[model samples]
Target: MPRTLAERTAAFPEPFSRVRGLRELSNGVVLLTDWIEEKVFAVDFGKGSATPIGRVGSGPREFRLPGRLVPLPGDSTLLNDVGNARLSVIGPDLAIHRSIPAQRPGAAYSMSPRGVDAAGRFYFEIPPWSQGPAAPKGDSVDIVRWNPRGNAIEGVGRVKGSDRPSWQREGKPRLTPGIPMVMFGSADGWAVLPEGRVLIVRSGDYRIDCLAGGASIGAGPPYAYPQLPVTDADKADAVATFLQDSPMSGRGPNGGLGHSPAASKEEVAAMVKTNEFATHHPYFRAGGVCRPRKASSGWSGRFSAARHRCSMCSTERAGWCAKCRCRWGGGWLGSGGALSTR
Candidate 1:
């Protein structure tokens, strides 16, 4: 089975240039925009292969170099264009709807913008300069929000900005600690949680830091999962099911033993006899092959895990069920698509 995953960038039209900005519009469409090239494009995200749906022209007045693509729940979308400080929206067919407009902020950013919340709100900051001696600097680089319906922009909190957007402010200073390799105006470089919470990922450290004021900051607990023997098809279905189940997880369990739904009937029976999965998850009254033969075309290594992260903590085993008691979980074979796992 494939042990890792990666995102492959698809080639665009000749004049299209590199996709500097990308996001998902509600109708399952993938939006791609280019700042240097000045254009916006859309595609079906669920297709076995990517396909562009539409294209539009958005030049200087619209976006100096649009940085990020944000799709709000409504008919609105936000573009991190230079002049405008907040998001801008485009209609279904391809028309600029409502946007705060990135007016010349007394400063121009060579970099493109990257992210925004589903709420149509986001933030940006100034940076230090290169080719000239300067320290990281900017206005009180802060986070703010915008409401499409109301067409309003409001301040949420401040992110320490520099007097200049030098190598450090860009998280590329020689003295900086770089882990995730986030550059200014990068996507997935900044993210909004499913809960509408904002967390800033330091491009250098890969350490996630919450942006909203009074937010908590800490690394999650070290977790591990078991690996199972299965074909690519079963693994694929399991990934889809798992993702469907956990709406906001970035990475899945670290494939491990018992964690794989590929366990044999006898192995499963023995596991259930010990009440392994049932102990952690109260909902898991039993454990066994909910189905196995049909696992190829319609197969999903199905196992039920007790709700792990909840308000109340129980003695129940959590995660991949390596050693915790009563671990509850589910899985599938590569029945869906092998690429889905990565």
Candidate 2:
């Protein structure tokens, strides 16, 4: 059975030694990490003090904002770049080696990538954000599997087609905890299980979705149909329908409910249908200083201006809604508005 939060904490190697950071290498050595203030530390089974690796990021070259790190074959380390959009390889000393850049930003969610393969090939993943803020409307994402050896990333499958592995019993830790199959964002990205099944998690009605890819597979829903008329009421209905199964409402880390409008309307419909939404609870993953307990307190104000604390504190971000942030399809709203020092 998967250990509960308390159980996992109790089983820590040492008391008072909380798990602050975590990353799994391609070699299967999961880094039990801790970041005290600004410094970083990770441990091995030897109980040696965690090495102070330089920094982490999700950019192409630098660790700009490393979401996760995987130990590549031959002592090489690949850092998933959240900022620069690339896979950065670093040496034992934490020096930059080579980087595999993403074809587009927003495509790969550097936060979670499966890792490199046997023959020096890297099977990375991109979320729905691959399409820049402005692209042809209705354009969704396609999982691009990058092969550094060949300097190419072929489309392995669409966001919804890569899930056979996630569903099989092969990927879960056979002996230990019971973490359900969640390939990145429910079924929104790439996941290759230990069984070698490459399954896609999709968003809408399966029949309407057109699965597309190379030898691999991808899926897309039909854009215009009798059921989806281009009327204001229909649009509202569609958006309301969109909210029902959006990843933003899930209970994953930081509230699990993070929204990505990159998927086109048809894509959105498909994602909901696949039922591959994030499952982590967001309330428990929140990070924020104690809110000044003045001029606010109530469930009603949670969405109102009075309640300023993070609603999804456990998993919620420290910003305003993505729509309110900029013309650029990201949410800048958070504890710190124009100048709150939040």
Candidate 3:
């Protein structure tokens, strides 16, 4: 049974400042990545304490701004250190076994490292968003499989075609070039399931897709939740949340970046007035596939409405199950994606 939020349970010695990712290891040990701390910690709920796993320096075993920590099949862990632009593989003993550069010399990183499958493959994208010099010419894929041993990435598949924005509806109004819009559930809502199947929610229509073996095998039914109309207050709240949570929002007190401490009043107000949120309000949910079968209805659970933080359970909230042990990627709130335990 899922514990109620009011239930007094095991709490870490100190609250986490900002959690970037979570992975459950065997023997009930939970691996967590703290963005603010720039390090990984192994928390043993049974013992009610967290032990720091790696250093926060730029050295071999250190991580700068980490992305996600994926617990692999053989008790190894894949860590995405985005600030340092490297992927460090940590062994069971909490040691860095190997580190791979995340970005290639000439290639751009579309999506940051999201997940690693059982086959030792890392999943992300090279979409070529409009803002960069390597912007795509109206063509780019959203999923790629990177093999660490070979030091290469293979295209897995693209997001569903219908998910693309429809500029035609508004006669293609002229907008600023390079302004970025995110994919389904933002960039964090994607996850690679066991057996190498990839699942992503389609933001355009709130549909979930299952891609595997280099093709999409199925898309889940539409969300049961009604799409709420966005209001000025809603927009303001969304923008404020972004400014508060985004790691790259802007310069910090230290003249550096990475989720700066509460922005100054003037800065926050300025950003709210000037910056624009996506016109097509970002739609997200807590969901995932229960199995890797090719049936159109292979997925379970309906998309639920999300507030500031989406903590919906794709399946029953029974801690970690066999299928979602890694949970490498997640949505904005670290809890938006399909959930199933079958």
Query: TM-scores of the models, in the given order?
Result: 0.40, 0.38, 0.67
Ranking by lDDT: 3, 1, 2
lDDT of each: 0.36, 0.35, 0.53
- Candidate number with the higher lDDT (1 or 2): 1
Order candidates by TM-score, high to low: 3, 1, 2
Task: Note the clash tally of each candidate.
Answer: 52, 67, 8
Q: For residues 133-184, what per-residue lDDT tens digits would candidate 2 score against the true structure?
A: 6322232444455655566656655443322334332434344322233322
Which scores greater on lDDT, model 1 or model 3? 3
TM-score of 1: 0.40
Q: Comparing candidate 1 with candidate 2, which one achieves the higher TM-score?
A: 1
lDDT of 1 by residue, 1-342 (tens): 112212223322233433445554445455666543445666553453344422322332254334455444453555655323435666665556655545433434432233344454444333334213433234234444545467565554444431223443455435432111111121112334433455543322223455454354543232233323333333333333332222122222232111113435454334333211111111111111111112211111112343343111223433333332222121121122211111
**In model 2, which regions exceed 4 Å deviation?**
1-21, 24-29, 32-40, 45-48, 55-62, 83-86, 91-113, 125-140, 161-189, 193-197, 200-342
Candidate 1 local lDDT, residue 15: 38
